[model samples]
Target chain A: MSDLPENLKYAKTHEWAKLESDNVVRVGITEFAQAELGDLVFIELPKVGRVVKADEQCAVVESVKTASDLFSPVSGEIVSVNEELSDAPEQVNDDAYDAWLFCVKADNPAELDTLLDASAYGQLIAE
Target chain B: MASYSTVSLPTVTTIHKTALYELHIELGAKMVPFADYQMPLQYSKGIIHEHLHCRNQASLFDISHMGQCSLKGSSAAIGLEKLTPAIISRLGSGRQQYTVLTNSDGGIIDDIVVTRLGQELTIVVNAACKEKDFKHLRKQLSNDCQLQELSEHALLALQGPSSSHVLQQVAPEACRLQFMQACRTEIDDIPCMISRSGYTGEDGFEISLPNRFAEKMARILLNFPEVEPAGLGARDTLRLEAGLSLYGHELDEKTTPIEAGLSWLIKNTHQSYPGAGTLLNQMQNGTEIQRVGLLVEAKMPVRENAPVFDNEDKLVGRVTSGSFSPSLGRPIALALIDTEAAVIGATLFTRVRNNLIKLTVCDLPFVPHRYHRS
Candidate 1:
């Protein structure tokens, strides 16, 4: 099983989010998801300052095999994007969590309740 | 059988496993349904490592799913030439050549490698097209010739710079063979008809033996530290970097040899094959669409069937195959474009999502081939 830190929250789509501040959240795909995606070649992130709804397709991640739409985990405005991924997209495969796609400022803080804890997400992929 | 391409092929409930299926599981391979067969997409070493390993050292690939068969008879060589555009009758025994089977309308039936070994000819076709390819050959051939499919055989390719060095540890005769040569040989007393050819554009040999000894041969080859197991993922990237076309991606029934950039295949001075009427006509007057290579400066990879356009946004062609070239550290693709725009160094556009990226028309063999010739 891939490492899933207990403090982080995960979406059923294999994205994990960590709350960096009171309302600010860091979002990226889970380690298990990156391994399944093989070597990531390119990434298209949502623009900074763009407002995105939870579960909305806001970005795209392309591997040699296929391209996948990256879904936003929370309804929020994007504050930052990983610009280096345009040339070094393999960072996600090297370290998924550290290579967050875009940071989001959550609209309603309690929306984190809708996400799964590390244990729950672990069980989801195990099935 | 189906394709390894996830971008293509429909979802299915059942899949056939190869003889080395258990061994792949033991190596911690990620299995996926390819050509309706459960196949290893990547091993524990990952696609990049396996790909580089094959280029620098040696890699063993279980390609048993490809269709292997024989055409036998006094007229096997002469009669077989009538169905395809290759000069099979003149191909000579002990040699193989890359050729295509064409339909009556001048479209390709399948791209295959035919090896003429004395009285018989051995053919290896794509697994996805084997069923229909066999049915078509049987229906078109005369009674004097016999078409036999090797249902109980397994194929493996040991490839790279050190392939012959590692293979010499088992079969010394492999070292004497040149590229595109085939001979009846043995490893550990198990009979195998090994060919000095491969799809990865490497100096390699494809070994075919009975199904019962499949794992035995794989184990023998893997005993060498230089020979590691590579999977279909690495196979795809390697072939793509080599600029070799995959069956379903770079070709299909609707595409012709001339349009697919395979005019060299029809240059044997004999066009007396099926589809000769239209194939010859197209050969005389150039094909409207020409298959060419593309180098993308952008980070995003242009995918198959993506609409290609001129700088003015006028539709000109479509991408046939695309990928991030591990060997070159950039994105490259094979596209079919209007003959007018197929000139080398011409600029083209491919739409990815909502973005139109610039592409330069380039010559093929993204990486140079290293085949060992006589």
Candidate 2:
């Protein structure tokens, strides 16, 4: 909750979704998740044109000691991925929200409404 | 809106804590359950930072979980020779040799380091196999040899280039000892059995002292600017880069020393150890599979149990140990593969999830060993 942006919504799987427009949303892991994963060394992002369902596995983040699957916060089509991460995965460790994993075009705009706000997400992590 | 199954947390289990447990906690270490003991995985500085520091300077490791015991008798070395293929009789006093305990079928029971102190032989064994190793020793050795577990003692490893200098301030005589030598000395008035050897393939010393003085000694060593506390995570990476074989991975009950790339440990003339028949046979002929180093082509780590395949998709071997080397700045591994695939520079493949990653056979010791021989 220390750096959880007030405007963005969060998924229980530790992913954050920021609606850029009516249909497009930027997705990334939370700062809390990155801190738990230690220093990341590699990341495998989903294909740009791949169709994904809400809460489905879409990417992977690997730290020096372990690797974790990143689940999609909402159902959509992946329009773009962060190419910069392939060269410097540590960028995500530097700033989790800033290093967006991918941009998805949401199939249903109402799905964002179901995500947790900053206060709710803060409580979940605190527990 | 969608519910995803959360990663299940490991159940709370009571585990043994070392004498340095409180010190490790105070140092902001991330504790993990390992070998039935609560051991430090890393400190606040992280694994990569600690690993690099060990290579450039020096680091201290709490290895109290490892088992230490002594075989007391004039014939202790000869008695131990019956269990291992190493020529222990020739080992002079105040010297140590890395050897393995073999079963009747030539399979490795456990790898151990045996030190000769006058007429007694002291040994250090793996933490996971300590109890079993001692039981085996008790049953196998003759009545003349008495086995005593040094359970009250705690062990510490101070490794890297500056290790000798750091240790010299407290125990001066330990610095003069050559590699693989041991001596009973006092450090800051605390009695200890100091040895010039370590698992990191670096110039270091393994200090064994009573548990009561462990925290005091650790604090003293930590006061030195050249020494920092390292955890089991960095230890694994350092040993991996050093190309040292880890038990339960590169070695197991079904694997022999010859197949594990430890043929040098088997003395050519001595063939009377537990599994001498099959060991000498493999030594004269060859093993079916050999442990070899691999240079992983992909950025992703190829971890243990990953299947290795040849060009035709035929399964040839499996990865024993794999990780992203902090020093090489790339992924490296060790695989026990068929003799045909053990060729240096030969390309092999390992499946990671949905992709087949390419791997090349490379020479061991991704990093060179820096021992203080002089």
Model 1: CA > 4 A from native = B1-14
* lDDT tens digits, residue span B180-201, model 1: 9999988999999999999898
State every prediction's TM-score relative to the real structure: 0.95, 0.95
Give Cα distance to truth, residue B100, candidate 2, Å: 0.3
How accurate locally is residue A13 in candidate 2, as Cα lDDT from 0 to 100? 88
DockQ-based class of model 1: medium
Tell me the tens digit of each residue's lDDT in model 2 across B140-236: 9999899999989899999999999998899989999999999999988999999999999899999999999999999999999999999998999
User: What's the count of clashing pairs in each model shown?
Assistant: 1, 0
Candidate 2 segments exceeding 4 Å error: B1-14
What are the root-mean-square deviations of the candidates from the true structure over C-alphas?
A: 4.1, 4.9
